[model samples]
Target: MTAHQNGNISAEVSDFLLNCFARSPGWQLWLSLPLSLFLLLAMGANTTLLITIWLEASLHEPMYYLLSIITLLDLVLCLTVIPKVLAIFWFDLRSISFFACFLQMYIMNCFYAMESCTFMIMAYDLYVAICHPLRYTSIITEQFVIKAVIFILARNVLPILPIPILSAQLHYCGRNAIENCICTNMSVSRLSSDDVTINRLYQFIGGWIMLGSDLILIFLSYTFILRAVLKLKAEGAVAKALSTCGSHFILLLFFSTILLVFVFTLVAKKKVSSDVTVLLNVLHHVIPAALNPIIYGVRTQEIKQGIQRLFMKGW
Candidate 1:
């Protein structure tokens, strides 16, 4: 019931978990303000996109519907991390409870998995539109689309449950600095007092499946897309095709780099000055969450015009 004498950490990971970070940069909330401002901007843009899709019957088609879902995912993606991250910085509440830390990690990963699935679906959607244009309607019907969404949602739910459960068993002896700003799996695993060989292995294994695999598939999808784009009969169609896939591809690259860096930085011994890696790791995460909506919203024309129209109508 009481905190471990040395702070309730496991005998094996006691030192590893303790004092890895100094209370965290949660106080950087002041610094996080600029990032928050960016998220706010995204929130507005994504909200408009959602509203426009719902209001316009023409936009109710599968493509727009999926776009709206992605927008919602993007919106939640930012909200889940940024607000809590900012709060930690703003209110000086950086120390997350073991329970709370596990929870944050779970929620964050849940959305991340969702992003992976969304990206996959987006790829398939493009595949159908480009590879088989004539059959697109029948192939990607409403029922089919709903099934895809459900499948992705299910995928997101399953892996995350084990993370928190396995983590709950770890005991923290004192070293709980939490290397990265948030309680990422890599950093948290390093703090284990118990035999973490399995944990480490699992981290590496999961990274390949969950993170690495997603990146590979995304690239493959784009390869097909680029091939299709080249064969397009008209310049305008090709341009439009590139425009659509380009944004998702760029974001995919962003995630692939940052996430791997985070994984490596965590697994690597701290013999070298890891501050740079840690910073990169945080930026990798924060930037993507902050930039997803902005990048997509700015790049997508309909979203841009819709935002202008939404507020303009109120005026």
Candidate 2:
């Protein structure tokens, strides 16, 4: 098996070297410091949030249970992508084996969909709590959350499992360098000698169908919540409702906006620098994970008190 002329890439290439920030070697150190900080913050904050919810028996409701699910997802997302990125930055360990890359791709693809679905159902929980106060207990019971968890798992895993399988089947004759820090479906598939039209179509169409539907459902849930909040007759009731929903709303905004920007830039790649595109993709995983617990902690009183109780017990 002779090496190809272009960079001498072999037909038997077994690993991919991530060309992260390849255009700006000087910036890798600069990026590494902040990335490391964010990873640490995300890990600490999410762990504390999970612990707070777990130990404080009072916090064990459908709402907190759902929050726990998202927190765990955030932790998993960070652990999956960030440490490997940090290795690339600090230790120059950019080579990811074919098996690991696809496994990472599968987790990356599947978890995000699960997170979106979780956010949609969470919005529904808020709606039921505010709109139908009397039936909230029955509608948003532990049983209801268990069912939602099952739905989230099934909805994402079955559809996304094919992504890596299809990607792995492509014949990579040469050019095994992935320009991004992560093993995105497109980044890996584009390296193949085979026609990747099916991969592109499945990724684009399937991703939109999953995320777009969740966004639409989330929008409707919040619309009803807003209407219900406005009709409240009690003084400060509106403020209280806004206060209750504000953190979740902020989280949703950051989640959706970052994802939208990444998708847009990814499609219109010519307009954006490749480094900028990769940077956004990296931050999309870290920024939201770091901020979700902090926003909820700052705005939600119950969470704030739970943290305090945990700290007091530790002290």
Candidate 3:
């Protein structure tokens, strides 16, 4: 089935079938089991963390609030990609409407960018708290978070909104199978008969502008944080300070590393199987969602205590 754009000569496919993995269907059933477990863990862990933060008055600071936002974005990102993926894997429900595909593409782009921006903000939060101990409270206020959120939303959403729209305008000439689990902009655009150079170039430029800037800022913030931590004369104080920022740094490292691996896999596509690339892409979304909350709950003392309080009350 094809969709006709307004008086245009080119035809677009009305729906798409996701090329999930190897053509053999048996492996997918086994694959779905672990993916389902990850989704469940991601949802459960993030929800519990959100609730713990909500109930614990001490966890109501700007840092926790930013963490909560990250949890929310992670939840949304997982929900957007995983359910449909499970449906595709388990039930052979591979067909996705054109508009639905674009919507998924848009959400994935926007949320990933938002998550990157949030990490940058969190890095700044750590920097302020550690480097400017006296002014940390004044610098990382509720109003500052609100402004940062606004900036994040506007910065990411506005630039990414056009990507899916541009893809939708392309003539898809009956090539409707997406070679990945999620509706990535490039994956969808590649199906189009038109030259995807513009699409690829725009996304490349926009991604660097958004994620690149954030990564650079995050690196600088951590550099300052490390320098400040080293200046402390007391070993105990240095250890305590490092402990506070260590978890955030670790999660950030995981996020950046996986993403870099995915990019490298794409660049080295001739040597890597498409399955490996697709698997990496899928893991990129779910792994962080599953791990971020667990890391925070384990590392953040207040959150750990709040979780204990919650469990004790339940008991």
All candidates' TM-scores? 0.82, 0.96, 0.94
Tens digits of per-residue lDDT, candidate 2, 1-315, equal: 432324365566677878897777777889999999999999999999999999998899999999999999989989999999999998988888888999999998899889899999999999898989899998999999999999999899999988999999998776888888999988889888889999889988998999999999999988999999989989999999988889889989877865676567768789767888788889888999999999999888898999999999993
Better of 1 and 3 by lDDT: 3
- Each model's lDDT: 0.66, 0.88, 0.86
lDDT of 2 at 90: 89
List clashing residue pairs in candidate 2.
none
Please identify model 3 stretches exceeding 4 Å from their true place: 2-11, 23-26
What TM-score would candidate 1 get against the native?
0.82
Clash tally for model 3: 0
Q: Tell me how candidate 3 scores on lDDT.
A: 0.86
| Cα RMSD for candidates in order | 3.9, 1.9, 3.1
lDDT of 3 at 264: 78
Which numbered prediction scores highest in lDDT against the true structure? 2
Which digits, one per residue and each the tens of the lDDT, describe model 1 over residues 1-315?
323324444343322222222444433544577767766766776676678777755556787777666677667766765666666556645556666677777877777777777777777887888878899999988887799889877876886677666765766554556665667776786665666666556655764687666667767877888888899898599988887777777767765675677557657746545555655644555566556656766887776676667678883
Model 2 residue 137 CA deviation (Å) reads: 0.5
Report the poorest 10 consecutive residues by lDDT, candidate 2: 1-10
RMSD score of candidate 1 (Å)? 3.9
